[model samples]
Target: MKLIKLDAIDSTNDFLKALSSQEELDNFTVVTAENQTKGKGQMGAKWESESGKNLIMSILVKDFLYDNEQVFNMSVIVSLAVIETLKSLDIPGLSIKWPNDIMSDNKKIGGILIENTIKSDGRIVSVIGLGLNVNQINFGHLQQASSLKVICNVEFDKDSLSFLIIEKIKEKIEFWETNSALFWKEYFNSLFRRGIPTPFKNLYNQNFMGIIKGVSSVGKIQILLEDDSVSEFDIKQIQMLY
Candidate 1:
């Protein structure tokens, strides 16, 4: 694991992507910053983090063995790794919201954004950017955000947490390379609100109650509705209501 630590950066993901283009980056190469001025979330949303108060990093996966279609599996692996790391810290109510948001007690504590590079022959390289709230005690007006210090009443060593999460991610990646089916099963089981009837809204603003069935191999969410019909949705097609 080649790690690059920065005091601040525009975005860890952007830095890693730029690095990959300039030179051959080792697999599992990581770029982390104390402050990401332009951190990103899913769907081009801005990720807000206080300087030196959270985990803001991006990992480069070069020469990935998986094909382009299995890119969703990489997201699952990274999400599970974050969940496992938090669990090891004795954090309660750990669950992964669909796609890649880390939730605890119904509040988001972290998120992930994955960008893929495909070659002419269809080989893939993934740049995964991750942000996790650590010691931040306030979210201003963001009511649904929480951090480790707020949730567990303890301050944590950010470097130590970063190392543990990276290690867990590498472990998941190794396991995924060998036993993908088993890893997928566990990923489904770790989903937030899995099998529970929850309120959801569509892009058209239609509201409905749906049970979280599971995610497809390609990362579409499967929701079973009250009408006994199952529907599949990609990100941004449907919104989960808290």
Candidate 2:
């Protein structure tokens, strides 16, 4: 539970990864920053945040995973952890967009980027980076973005929120260690737009209609096609048009 607070950084995930390489870090070591110069999201998208307005942090989880292929399991654990934290705050319409985007009322409020490294000795280390919009209001042209303050009409304490989320993550990690089936069930139930026909786009920007069934075992989205065929698509191959 070692915590390091920073005024700003290039990316908390990068910083923690570098730190872990140089020295032995305690499990659940956390690094939080007020701002990120090169904040990033899934698939190399830029994550922009207002200074001192959000939860920008990365956590180091050492040797908890059995192998590198279980990254999606880690994703599920962390995603549910964030959702539980937000739900405890009474945030309405909380759902997980596939691959781990936190959504409320169909707008994204937070996101997760997990970076895993397998050491030479086969120890799997994960650096989980989370960005949650808290008090910041303006998103410029990003229409599908909103924050806790915007959704609930009340300001939030970033420190308290960060602590709660981290604690929830720790709890979920413990829970998932033995109750993987139950946690996966929770994930499918909390999935956004499940069982409803939705528009999706392919890599070439072609639109199609599909219903999100659930995620595949390999971490891809499972969509029921228009012709009654269920297909799995990687995150890079398809984009949900909500």
Candidate 3:
């Protein structure tokens, strides 16, 4: 559980990748950057934030899984881990928007990116990157972003807050590894807009309306259709529209 904190870095994810090849960094080794020069988001989206005003870090976890299918569940692991961390901070209305956005009052407050790499020893390693909006008091032109400072009307000590978050994540990870069913159940309970009809655009660019019924055990999002039946989709297969 050693943490390496950097004043700035090109990207914490990249830093971890570089370290990964240099003799396996132990599981729970964390690298964090106060400012990320080239932050990355899912699907090549850009993750940007005002310098030193957010939480940007990557965790190196070796032996995360045995197969490719289990790789996809990393999203569930990270999202639920973060949700638990935020809840421990007494943050209100915090919920997870599947595949990996953390939301509060329907506004995005954090995100996670889980990358899997195959090691030379035939093991899989997971790099879980998390970017959380913390003490930045204003969203300004970033219409969809929000911060803990904005919500709570007070600033937080960045380093202490980051450590607290990591501690919560570690605790949740253990809980998830032991009680998976209860983990998923708690995760589903924190799902944003669950049971409420929402609009989404599918991969084919077709629009559809469905209610979030919760996620299947296999990790696909279960969407309750208008016909009273249910369907499920992987990430990016369906984009929920705000």
- Of candidate 3, the 10-residue stretch with the lowest lDDT total is 168-177
TM-score of 1: 0.96
lDDT for each residue of candidate 1 in 1-242, tens digit (9 for 90 to 100): 89999999999999999888888888889898999999999999999999989988899886654576778988988998899899999999998999999999799999999999875666688999999999999899999999999999999998898889889888887777687888888889989999988999999999999999999989999999898999999998999998
> How does each model score on TM-score?
0.96, 0.97, 0.92
After superposition, candidate 1 runs with Cα above 4 Å error: none
In model 2, the runs with Cα more than 4 Å from the true position are none
lDDT by residue for model 2 over 1-242, one digit each (tens)? 99999999999999999999999999999999999999989999999999999999999997678775677998889999999989999999999999899999789999999999989888899999999999999999999999999999999999998899889888888777689889999999999999988999998999999999988766889999999999999878999988
Residue 181 lDDT (model 2): 89
Candidate 3 error regions (>4 Å): none
What TM-score would candidate 2 get against the native?
0.97
Candidate 3's displacement at residue 227, Å, is 2.9
Better of 1 and 2 by lDDT: 2
- The candidate maximizing TM-score is 2
lDDT, model 2: 0.92
